[model samples]
Target chain A: MTLTTQQSKEAEIGKKANHLVLVVTNDTIDKVYPPMILATTGAASGMDVDIYFTFWGLKLLDKKGQTQTKIASVGNPALPMPNIMGMLPGMTAMATKMMKGKIKKYWPTIPEMMQQAKDMGVRFHACSPTMGLMGMTDKDLIPLTDSICGASTFLDWATDPNSVTIFT
Target chain B: MLGTSLATTDAKPAMVLDTKGLLCPAPVVKTSQAVKQIQVGDVLQVLATDPGSKPDLTSWSRMTGNELLSVTEDGGSPKVYTFLIRRMK
Candidate 1:
């Protein structure tokens, strides 16, 4: 069957543009959100998306991480409670529950978003060097992770025309 | 200009997706999925309530190479935004 003109144009455009890459460097609830949001958005935009989790970022991929949402508030400027109060026991969980309540109506939860991102073809990469430092294995992370890779390897893949690479 | 205008003014939509009460990526993501269900060159009309969905869907369509035929805003208070997009791939 002959391809329609619109379909041909789409194929041509897809051929011209490469994927978007995001480097996640932190695990704190607030910090982890940026990369997740971008990866999810990139997938929805019909762009291939890769998120490389390194250092503390890898913690987010841990099965324990996404199971419970906790926002680090000790130094967070956005935290409504006092810094001293943030250090109090159970405050982090309280803050996390509050945040979850606020966002439940308007957005998908972090774990739900992660599943959706995966369904939309977003790739998650774990940093090998960081895993070695943290004494972790593939068993520690969620099943969505695609690879345990080095920085240079990902950098090599990221270098291209019209590719969006972000570090956060 | 002629082609764009023709597309914007009179391209009849093949499907309508109602995304009211859905927010941010939901509306945009739903539009993305809805576009895939139609044939190439067929228009998909999306009704979204999220204020952020317009720019998000606009940029998404740009990145995906889909044709954004028109965006019409309805009502004044708590406006309803309508997007008409044609499937390309």
Candidate 2:
């Protein structure tokens, strides 16, 4: 079949770039790290990586809310303490601080990682419906945002045959 | 004599990246970024302390079309791992 110029251009892009698509739906520190780490490393490996932040995950894209993210000390099996103990006042803060201390020793903070990912050409997409649902406009998002897109647009990118989609 | 010949054949790095205290993925990330600073086919020498860097760098070079020419371990107190990678593209 004969291909038009636009079609061939898209075909060329598809042949050249392998895609890594991540759908992040949570905002906790632990939940946020995997997608960020994978996206950064995947981009380093020469993949075209995209992260679609929806629901709570979209909150990470917000400048104000991004800094407020905390590690979940309650109801987390990975925590050394019992759930009842985790209910104590300041437990979340203590846990978050402890985790941050450990991570800071050898790794970049989440915000720094996001910046590195952006520098490495990892594209960040904010969910359009979620933005409306949360009453957030583009001005509320961090400067790293690449696009505001709906699920269909994200799916179109994710549907590439060479792409791998991860949901967290 | 063998060591002398091997040393003579070793490719000198066009750039060096020190990621000694940094952990996994960071070293790889930094190496990827550093590789871009040099011309294609130039070698990038990366020094890292994370134990996982050996495997991570090996896989990264293989996946990114770069050549993993050699890996040297200092075996010091922190056990530094050094990698020489040639960017093919």
Candidate 3:
């Protein structure tokens, strides 16, 4: 009834073999959700999950970026209000607040989600070029970040034939 | 396969974790927590209401190197998902 050592070992190898690579290029509240959800779920499922943050996405890792992140209600058809209505100056804040309210019920706030992602073993990688472009240093970001990496380095991780990759 | 009934199953599970209404990582997280309570090779039964629980638990089982012996819907108007997972490690 018991599995042989080799059989169990094979199962162990399968369990550890999966990986998910997520690339985040936007820092908006909507933009961050996909990778956050993916990373947390992927890592939770026993797969290795590494997220590469580049350009605007790097801002989300900054200590105060999430607080200032806005939702893209304008030009978004999913919104109840029209694009013209979304053009109002306060529309972004309103939309962001509305999103926060809706998401708070089921999902954690941005900061909490970020913490949870880290707790789930989701590795955060800050793109090196974006770090310089944003004029930000390691000290500017949260401690959750594993390291600053270049495109080539991130590509190497995504290039793994066995791993699933996503860009958001 | 789970509808076969646990009584006729090869081995009984150490615990049953009901994750109805819970979504996303909740089911997986709870399963991980419950899995620790059982010994190696012991099974854990999870009853969930979330549709996502299917893929979630499936991948979780695979990711943890566990054996997913069965997955089936319970009899009723709205089907519930039941997963029989054996802790391989």
Q: Which stretches of candidate 3 lie over 4 Å from their true place?
A: A1-17, B1-12, B72-79
TM-score of 1: 0.86
Q: Report the C-alpha lDDT of model 3 over A74-124, residue by residue, as the tens digit.
A: 778888888899988888889989988888776777778788888878899
Instruction: List model 2's recovered fraction of native interface contacts, to 2 decimals.
Output: 0.65
Each prediction's whole-model lDDT (CA): 0.80, 0.85, 0.79
The model with the greater TM-score, 1 or 3, is 1
Q: C-alpha displacement of B81 in model 1, angstroms?
A: 0.3
lDDT of 1 by residue, A5-24 (tens): 55676676766656888988
**TM-score of every prediction relative to native:** 0.86, 0.86, 0.82
Measured by lDDT, the strongest candidate is 2
List, in order, the clash count of every candidate structure.
0, 0, 0
Q: Please say which candidate is ahead in lDDT: 1 or 3.
A: 1
TM-score computed on alpha carbons, candidate 3: 0.82
Which residue runs of candidate 2 sit more than 4 Å off their true CA positions?
A: A1-17, B1-9
